[model samples]
Target: MTGARAMLPLGAALALGLWLWAVRDLPWPGWPLDPQAMTLDQIRMGYGMMPRGVVALLAGAALGLAGAILQVVLRNPVADPTTLGISAGAQLALVLATVAAPDLLGPGRWPIAMAGG
Candidate 1:
């Protein structure tokens, strides 16, 4: 198999293994019919750790996709947010909004970031 194709499963396995290791301390919240029956550890695992893990995984996937798209569009293998100044622009915008118009940030930060990027 090609190197990239071969590495896909390896990367996924490594991520999964790492996630499992990170959450090893948390007790598994098995299929509980009643929420009241769940213990503190189970509730923390189910409500806190699980959603955060899912969000982290999704965000990582999205960043990878964005990087791939940027590289392809720019015709440069090393193209990234920094290369295009997107991240800097976004941060600058946020800082400016915070200093100039704090109200704008109170509503939502995503709009300002998108506008700047």
Candidate 2:
């Protein structure tokens, strides 16, 4: 097997294990949804933090993919978000949106930022 194909499962398993460990102390030996086993705080924290962490992880992965694709497409190792001015342009658009039309960025700032980029 190719190196990446061989390593992907191992990497995914390691990440999953680390993520499970980082979730929180669960009510083991009892039921997962058993309120009597775990406190409300523990439940809230496990549920809340896991989703946020997943979202952050996904976002970072997406950005990494985008950067890699951009570099490959441009045939330049230095062609990243910042070097391509996408980062600066997006920031400028955010600033402009905040100043000129805050409402445009209220619910969905992605299209606006993308347009600006």
Candidate 3:
């Protein structure tokens, strides 16, 4: 158990490193798929290399932990996050946001969705 605990950071670091390496050289496009193309390097660089990777990993871990907790609390093997209507609440918010103001649906969407849940 302790050995595995020590490997967690190394495992995460390796995963992140691999993801970055794979994406760094792939061809990524903006709004349009085009004949003249740029590699993934160009697309990532254009985004100014913002550190969203940590946030993404953290959010993923949080959701995973939440689902685990919810399943345990609900006392059912199949009680996933969706079983609690969380998924429906999220979908409803997305639909509402799309109808209300599609442009303002980035960060605000989750908060509104969770609130609805």
- Show model 3 residue runs off by greater than 4 Å: 1-50, 93-107
Query: Which residues of candidate 1, in runs, are more than 4 Å off?
Result: 18-29
Model 3, CA-based lDDT = 0.72
How much lDDT does each candidate structure score?
A: 0.87, 0.80, 0.72
Highest-scoring model, TM-score:
1
Query: Per-residue CA lDDT of candidate 3, range 15-109, in tens?
Result: 98998786775445352344346455655644545457667778999987988788789887688857778888888877887898788677677
Query: Which digits, one per residue and each the tens of the lDDT, describe model 1 over residues 3-72?
Result: 9999999988998899778877765736475669888778777788789978997998999998999999
Ranking by TM-score: 1, 2, 3
lDDT of 2 by residue, 13-108 (tens): 999898778644654334367666667766665567657877999999998898889988999988988877998898899999989999888688
Candidate 3 vs. true structure, TM-score: 0.45
Instruction: Give residue 106's error in model 2 in angstroms.
Output: 3.5
Query: Whose TM-score is higher: candidate 1's or candidate 3's?
Result: 1
As for TM-score, the candidate ahead, 2 or 3, is 2
Return the TM-score for each candidate structure. 0.81, 0.64, 0.45
Worst 10 residues of 3 by lDDT: 27-36
- Best to worst by lDDT, what's the order? 1, 2, 3
Which of the two, 2 or 3, has more lDDT?
Answer: 2
